[model samples]
Target: MNKKEYLEKLESELGQMSYKDVKDIMDDIGEHFDEGVAHGKTEEDIAAGLGSPEELAKSFREGGTVASVLQKKQAPVQNARQKDTTASAIFVILFNLFVAIPLWIAIVCAIFTVGAIEIGLIAGLVGLVLAIPGFGNFLAAGICLAITIALAVVFVAVLIILVTKYFVIGTGKYISWNKKIWKEGL
Candidate 1:
């Protein structure tokens, strides 16, 4: 089939995609077909070289357009809950780094330097209350703080693993596998 005929067939089969998307994909297939034809291949040879129409449609549906793929290595996954959870985890991590750790240090310093355990306890309690959700209408802020702390911790651990993996021989292979799985939507 010619490029236009192949595209029309693709459009009919994949009804949900936009015309522009189909056209762009067809253009890519046409380029490959043209290359094969230049090399003395028949139309049937060109079509087979491009692979099955169903497989091509599946790639477009899951991977998005070539333009979008070039813009970002991996398409964003389509799970709303997953996105929310990732956001929450990241928030918890930041909270731990900036708020929780500093407050804990201050409390410890107060107890040792000034010999004022009561003062330290009071400050620590205040900090804990502020950190806890539903202690006031600041429940949302508390929730955010918790999430930030959690995500920060996870980020740190991942960073450490990445660094160590790259430096170590066998560990680097595992690191490469982790990245591949992440990219492939596993």
Candidate 2:
């Protein structure tokens, strides 16, 4: 049979084997066929030399079982440590993305709050200058200035809170915790 037909037969017979494992074994068998062809063996001769697919699959399963057992025995301690490190790393990354990024964004928004106030102040000053001869104009400018100053103060406060929470609390505590976990694992 051709390679495709042979692979299909193997897949049907190997009930629990992964497709990748079956494919790898098929590749090895294909290589043997190629070698036989190079040595002037006919397709029939090559087919006769290669064992049955069912038998080959049993061998593959046996090998897989032995390998799995060996793998578990060889690295139980390392595997436990690797699992801990992986969990810690994931926590650190998630904390940075959710907590740190949002905190930093809040701080940036706070800084921009001052800029918004400055813009408002400039606008108010322009209005004041235009209203030079009118009491109404002065009153309007004063209101604008008050509103701007309030916004600036609120923004400054928000920025301070965000910076303190991220740098002083979240980062300081979690980063050190992550480092300690990594060192202990190593």
Query: lDDT winner among the candidates?
Result: 2
TM-scores vs. true structure, each candidate: 0.31, 0.32
Candidate 1 Cα RMSD after full superposition onto the native fold (Å): 23.7
Worst 10 residues of 1 by lDDT: 110-119
Per-residue lDDT tens digits of candidate 2, residues 1-186? 655566567677777878788778778878877888899887566766666767766776787787888888889878888888888777767776898679767866775776566567666656655564566657776667656756765676676567556755765685687687655542
lDDT of each: 0.63, 0.70
- Model 2: lDDT equals 0.70
Model 2 ranges with Cα > 4 A deviation = 1-82, 122-178, 181-186
What TM-score does prediction 2 earn?
0.32
Q: State each model's C-alpha RMSD to the native.
A: 23.7, 14.8
Per-residue lDDT of candidate 1, residues 60-81 (tens digit): 7887676777656544544644
